[model samples]
Structures are given as C-alpha cells and as structure tokens.
Target chain A: MTATTSEPGLRPVQKSRYKRRSKGRGNFEMWSWVFMRGSGVLLLFLVFGHLFVNLMLGQGIHAIDFAFVAGKWSNPFWQVWDMLMLWLAELHGFNGVRTIINDYTEKDSTRWVLKTLLVVSALVVLVLGTLVIFTFDPCVDPGSTLSQCK
Target chain B: MTATVEENTEAKPGAVPTFEVTLRIERYNPEVDDAPHFEDYRVTVHGTDRVLDALHQIKWDQDGSLSFRRSCAHGVCGSDAMRINGKNRLACKTLVKDVNPGKPITVEPIKGLPVEKDLIVDMEPFFQAYRDVMPFLVTTGNEPTRERLQSQEDRERFDDTTKCILCAACTTSCPVFWNDGQYFGPQAIVGAHRFIFDSRDDGAAQRLEILNDKEGVWRCRTTFNCTDACPRGIQVTKAIQEVKRALLTNKF
Candidate 1:
C-alpha cells in the first residue's frame, strides 16, 4: 500500500458506469413503476366510486342484499366499471406485493416460490372476478323473486 | 513520574477492559497492485476505542503506506464511512468491542462506488445525485428583512430528513443503487424530502416533478437497508414511502 501514485481503474467519472439501455424488452421494470403510479391513481377513483355506489348511495348500507347486487350487475355500465376495477386493482396489488417480495426475500428459491404463488393467486381471482362481472345472470331461476329478474 | 504513571494506569472498578484484536483491511493501491488484497493488523485496544482509532494506530506505527480517511474523528463529519463486518457504518461511531468483539473486524470501502485507492471511494456520483435533488431551500419571495418564521408543527414535518450528513452510507447500502447507479438513490430522495415537506419552501412542486422521473423515488424497493445503515438513525425507508405517497397525493 502506497500513499498515492498511479491511475489504475481510478479515472475521472465522466459518465455514469450505470449501463441502462433506453430501449428494449428490458423496459418492463420502468413500465412496472409507471403502472404503479397510474393504476394507483385510477384505483382511487374506481374504489371510491364503487364504495360510494355500494355503501353510501340512495339505499345506503341498509339496502344491501343479494338482490341489490344482482340489480347493479344487470346494467352494462356496472359490468364495465366492475371489470376495470377488478383488473386494475388486482394487477396493481400484485405488482406492489411482488416488489415487496423482491425487497425482502434474499433466497432465490423463496422469491421464486412466493412470486409464483402470488401470480397464480392473482390470476385466479382476476379470471373468476371477470367471469362473475361479465357473465352474471339475475334470471338464473325462472321463479326468482329478485327485481332484476322481474 | 514513571511510578505515578504506572499507578494511574491501573484499571478502576468501572473501567472497561482492553483486548487484542485484528483488523482485516482491504488494500488496493492502483499504482502498485493490479488487484486488491487484505492486510491484517494486531492492535491492543480498550473496549471503548472506536474502529477509527485502530486504523490510526496502524497508519502511525505499523505501516506508513496504509491509507484511509478521517477528519472529525467523530461521527459528525461522515468522513470515515466504510463497510465494517459486512455493513456500512461510520468508523468513528463503531466501537471495536460492539461489533463481534473477539473476531477479526473486516474493514473495506463502501460498495457500489468505485475505489480510488484503499478505503477512499469516488463520491462524485453520489454527490451528483445530491445535486440533482436541489438540496437547498428554493423560496421565490424576496429576501426577508427578518428571518422566515416557521411554526413548530411545520418545522417538525421535515425534521427527520434534515439530519442527513451527505454520507453515502445509506445510498451505497441500497441494493437498488448498487444494481442501478443511474437511479437517484435514497440519500438524494431524503435530500429532496427535506425541501419537499418544508412548509416555508416553494420548490416542492418542482422537486416533486423532478423526482417523478423513471429513476427517481419509484426505484426504491423498501429494502430497509438504508434505514438500517443510517448512522443518524433517520427513518430513510419511511421518508421514501412519504415521497411515494406525495407523488400520488400531490401534497406533503
């Protein structure tokens, strides 16, 4: 060890050593970050709107029942709203949890297992929720007393 | 005089015990060596002695070639931040006895920064990020005749982030920063937060817009490594979270 002498790899930092390509399929991480903020903002509206309509609307909490849900889903407008909410909320939440797993899980296998479970579970919920929202039928039974059926 | 000095040197009841320890320091001389290697030094130190003291002893007594940085010899200047036993810490703040007493303490340059020589790393990139955040207060008003008065509540809002010392410990410890050097690391975000939350500052919007870039606060993965490595005990992860929330809420 000497006090000071020659230039090894120690050159002036002209440009950043960080080599991030501006364009590629590798832009997934960048898009993921963008999606978090975008979906987060969208979710605030969708979630609050869903809440306002479901819990605090004309009938309020007291009016909620199986038939009340059937009536809302009967409308095409509600179907799209619910579908958008389901997709955005699930993907947003899944990405958030995936980030968390990446941060905490040091073991490669543990991260792989946890992320796999998360993606599978989120897909399951998204597929099921979408089916329920779009394919829902209030008149499944001909003798049903629901107002939606009548 | 020698007899009196010997008598005074005797340990008192509450005096901490001294122990012989080894310091395994990573040595890299770009002039002389192609690759880095470790040099071990045996030094007898009191339990209260900091790791910096051991380095000083080695430089003074053992090998004059040994190179490291120290200024205040206290934690305030943040000059001697390095990896001690696989963690970033201020050498002056870490007591030898506290970090694995009997084992050899390993000292190396902080990770994610290019080593110029020995323990000193090039801090230009780190400071560049700091500069990008605009760490100064940016109020638009004319110079006040009197001091700009802040209410107690408002002052306290950004107090935690105000303790930053420009030490790259938190920034270098972050895996995100380690992996992607382009990302404005935690230290920069903490600096931005200092101004972003200050009630008297008018630059919050501009700073927030700057941070909204792809490699800004969103790059933080909340590893808690920054929080853990902070010598000032600043809640770095919490500050990052607050900034993230601000990005969406558009408020403090």
Candidate 2:
C-alpha cells in the first residue's frame, strides 16, 4: 500500500498503480478537473432554475398538475429550457459516471458488463426522455374542442 | 580508497546496457482486416522511459503510421486509454517501470468498443451510454435564496461520484463488455450513482426504474477493474453495489 498523489482521503496513488503500465502523467485528471468545475457551474443554473420555475414561482409546487406541465410545454421557451437541462445534466452526469466506473471495478468482465449496461440504459433513457418531452399531449378532454393538441 | 578503473565494477564485462522487451499489441485496419491480430514489437529500450514514451518512440523511429491516441501527454485527457498487460490504463499516466518491471508490456485498444486503429477504440458508444442516465438533479421544491440549501452531509453523498471523466478505461477493460457490447457498463452506473446518491435530486425514482431493467445494475459482478483502472480512484464497484442496494430496498 503506497501513498497516492491524488486527494489524500481516497488513496489515489495506490489505485493509479494497480496495473501501473505506462506514464499517464495526469492528462485525464486535468481534463476531469476542468469538466467537474465546468459541469458544476452549468449544473448550478440548470438545477436551480428548474426548481424555481417548477416549484416556487407563479402557481408554485401545487400548480404542477398534468395540465400545468402541458401548458408549460406549449411554450417553446420552456421546451428548450427543459431540453437543455436534460441534455446537459444527463451528459454531465454520464461522463461523471464514466469516471466512477473506471475507478472502482478491478475485474475485466465485471467492468465490461456494467459499462455495456450503462450505455444501453443511457440510450434508452435519452430516446424515451426525448420522445416524451417532445410528444406530450396535455388534454384528456377529447369530447370538448377547447384546445386541440394538434 | 583509490578510485581506479581496476577496482570499479561499473565497467564489468557482459553487463548489458539495454534490454529488449516484447510488446504483443492488437492490430486492426478497417481497410485490410476483418478482425484484429496480435503483432509483437521487440524494442531495445531504456528502463526509465514510460510505455507511452516507448510508444512515442515506436511511432517516431519505427513506424510513423503506428496509430494511437494521445493528448496532454499526461493522464488528464483520458484520450490515450489502452489495455496494458491485461489491465486498463491511461497510456500517458502509465510508466514503463510499473508495467514492464524488466519485462515487455503488451498494449492494445480498449475492448467493448469498435476498434479504430492500433491503440484507439471508438468512444461514441461510451458517450451514448453516459447521455442516458438523466444525470442532473431535478427538484420540485423551493430553491434556497443561495446555494440550493444542501446540507454538508447531503452534498458529500454525491461528492465522490462527481469526479468521473468519461474516459472509457473501466468500460473497455471489463470482460463482460468483451462478450456483450450492449451492456450498460460501469461508467453509466457511476454517472447515475452520482445523482442517485445526491440528496437534492428527485429523479432517483425514475433513474432506478431505468437501472432496474433486464440489462441494468444487476449485471455488475464486482470484479473491481473499474476501481483498479480508474485514474481518479472512485470506488465504482461500491457505487454500483449501492445502486443495486437502492434497487433492492426502494431507497436511493
């Protein structure tokens, strides 16, 4: 068990030496540092605004009924906003996860299985989430011609 | 003591100045090859140079067309990840001393993805998996006037998970991915785990549903390659286990 140069708490150096094949010299580490701060900064806005608009402002949390969501989706602004949030947060989170996966598993088989599952799940979620956001129909009141979803 | 050549062993006869190491690397060419093959490179090398430096030497002196990915020449870019001596590693971060130990170090592209060249594997599938996790926090509560009102403990839950860098080292080194390319893999789970453990996120329920599918978190066997190969030391298997625990107990 050797001491590590990474953050002292996690024993980063030991992990870096497990295979200890070649000189990586902290390239991925540097990019990861940049990514965390960049994504963290972006997530601050995306997460905060998402909360404020969905819960605090205007009608507040209780106003978030099905019809309220439909009404919000009626505007392109909210659509784009939610879209951006979904893409950014999901991508950021996924990359963050990739980092985690690389860190923990020690077996080749185990790592592959988990990562394969991750990619498939991410694809499914992105496809389904995008579809739901774009194709949402708000009104169930088909009998009345009040507002046509079309 | 007299400093004479007769008494010095530094000039000992038959002392080899260099050693030749055998590198059994996987080779692939989209134009000429249907599958990859192991090509051996016997290099007369200095002990101090890293494997990446050796690769650089190969590309520079032996074969300019010996393709591989490298940027930042350091471990941060995650672009130069490869399989070395049966383990995943960032080429730039790996040193020859550690891998060879007076032997040759084998290098190959990461598995679980399509190979682009000698040591470069496709990352689109890896990134595609990352995009699926709905990785951001979704809250329907009042935001604090400042900093979103997360307790230190709550923030700490996701803190360790926040260090990931989509390098594909863990995913490619995995054996399961070598067999089945469709698996969600560790990186995605790590990403989901970041949000799953986040106290402020309301999407845990939804994310759990996504992870509980047939090809979900249950697939992990806990080999710890992700942990071993992770340049960042994230405890990826533990996070996956946590996610599995969350799935079993209705708690994120």
Candidate 3:
C-alpha cells in the first residue's frame, strides 16, 4: 500500500488568514491607549478639584446654586477650567466606551451601529455641556434676587 | 471492561489504591455528528494517575474510538492542552486527584480554534499567529566573528517570556480571542516578546509594527486570563504589557 501526501501548512513567510489587516490605521490605537492613561491622570485632578470646590469649600453643597455657577463662570479662569474638564471628561469617557464596544461587538455592522450611537450621544453631551459652561447667563431669570443678577 | 473500583481492588489486593473516575469529554466527529456533545466513560485509575492516564485508559480498554493528542506524557510537549474542569490546562500536567476526581472531570477542546476531532483542534491558526510574530531572532549586518554576547541583566529582561511552549492554552483562554479570532492572541504577543526585548535581535521594529495593528496588541484588554491559563507559568499578560510599553516608548 502507498501512503498519501497531505497538503503543506503555512510557511513562515506566509501571513495567517486571521492576521490583522496590513493597512493599519497607523498609530491610532496606540495613541488612543496613551490618551486613556494621560487623560485619566488629568481627570483625577480636575474631577477632585471640581468636587472639592463645589461640595467641600465655602457653604459646601448648599452653595452650588445657579448664582454660584454664574459667579464661577463669570471668571475667565473658571471658564477655562470648566471647559477643559468638560472636554477631557467627555473624550475620555467616549474613548473608553468605544473600546468596550469594539471589544464586545463581534459583527462589524453591529459595532458600526453601536459606535454610531455612541458618537452621536457623546457629541450631544459634549456640545450641550460646552454650551452650558460658556453661554450660561447669570440673570436668565428676570425676577432673580441675587446681587450678580441685579 | 468497565470494572468497579472494588472489583479492581479485590483483583489486586496489594496494588495501589485505585478509584473510578468518570471523564465527561466533549466529543465531536465532523464526519458523523451534527454538533458536539458530551460523552462519559468510567475508568479505574490509580492514586498517582494524571488526567492523560485516564484518557489513555479509556482509549485502550473501553473506547478505542476516543481520540486525543498526547506526546511525552509530560508538560514539555505542550500538545495536550485542553479544558480540564472548566479551566485550560495540560492533561499530562494535571493530576486526576488534583482536579477533584470525585466529580466527573469535564475535558473539552481549547476554544477559538476549529476542533478537528474529539480533543484535537486545528493548531494551524495558532501556529500561524506564532509565525506571524517571527518568533526566531533576526540579525542584519555581517555575521559576528563570534556569537553575539549580552550581559546577564539584558538576558533577564525577557526571561519570563522564554518559558512559553506555544501551548495555545493562554491564547484559547482569552475572551478577546474567543470573540475575535482575528486578534493576534496572547501567545503571539509572548512569542514576539521573547525576541522583541532580546538585545541581539534587530527585528523588534518589524515585529512591533506587526503587533501595532488594530487586532494586534491593542485588542488585549488586560484580562489576565492568559497568565492564569499558561501551563508553563509564563507571565503572558506582563509580556503583552511590556510589548505595549515598548510600542508606546519606541524603546524595547
């Protein structure tokens, strides 16, 4: 009896069918990973500061009325700080959730849908948050009794 | 052929204490079965027998149709990696008693690979990933007059990743690999790490570039499943992290 030959396996030079696409998005994933770490550290300080000032300093949580926000945003430093916090927090959260979506969603179409929804929601929050931080009016209420409103 | 433990004990009075171990193995015959199913077999095994031994007993005495792979009957060959009692382990390395022989031990093929038979998976994909990383050292320039030398400290940088035996245990245990087979799993990253951090290898840039793909090192979520599943105790996740760090710093 004669022995039959089997097909040869992949050679060292041959790429696997499962290999990631060669035309990669360059350093996008690496930069995203770095962004997560960098933004995470910055978020720690920004979030803690925001919390300490709003919930601990002055009259504490009771002092966080609309007038307080109006007074804070009226200053350029507070405006810049709040804007940075809003942008960093939104992008950080969006990137983190995007990663989760990519990890869990196996189908490309499904990932596309979820990611589209994620981007849309993130955009809405970011735009609204930025708008609220910058365009907030202290005297929007006509009958306001606060000195700043007067 | 299916003898009770008491019968076996009675047959050999002074023999080592033997117990009946029921191995519930997930079996699939592509030629016959439409889907994979579990099949149980009772084998009388000695106190010191490994899971591989019980499998052999079933194949030799009770069911000749049972198929599995085993080489060296020790941990070095890395050919017998399977899911033993819900965890990825080498059957030859896992003792029957160590895995609670009182309950039926469940043995199944490793995940994320095409199961070619009962306990054998088509390891081509795993090997492909390994080969994709260029596991061997690559050198450029003229050959050294003597073998390239390195300090002990430099050698130890990647020593932890050198223990990998390409078992596929670590890769198969990964949830990311399970969800996306395209992702170059932990084993490939370890394979790359073995050479990437090597002071002598000039292939770090190429291998790191390959791993920078979307489905490459970035796909790893630091789940640590690979580290826990490694039969050789290699720090699989740490190697992956080092690779990621190397990519970030452009310094291996």
Leading candidate by DockQ: 3
Model 3 lDDT per residue over A19-110, tens place: 56557658888888888898999989999999999999988998887778889998989999998898999999999999888777867899
lDDT of 1 by residue, B1-252 (tens): 001012333558766567788999989888888767788999877767899998998999998888888889888988899988888999999988787857788898887778888899888889988888798989995989998999999999999999999889999888766643767888999999999999889998888777777667777877799999999999999999898778778632
Candidate number with the higher lDDT (1 or 2): 1
- TM-score attained by model 2: 0.56
Point out where model 1 deviates above 4 Å.
Answer: A1-15, A18-150, B1-16
The stretch of ten residues in a row with the least summed lDDT in candidate 3 chain B is B1-10
Cα error, candidate 1, residue A145 (Å)? 31
Largest TM-score belongs to which candidate?
A: 3
TM-scores of all predicted structures: 0.67, 0.56, 0.90
TM-score for chain A in each prediction: 0.81, 0.73, 0.83
- Chain B superposition TM-score per model: 0.93, 0.84, 0.93
C-alpha lDDT of candidate 2 relative to the true structure: 0.69
DockQ of each: 0.09, 0.01, 0.25
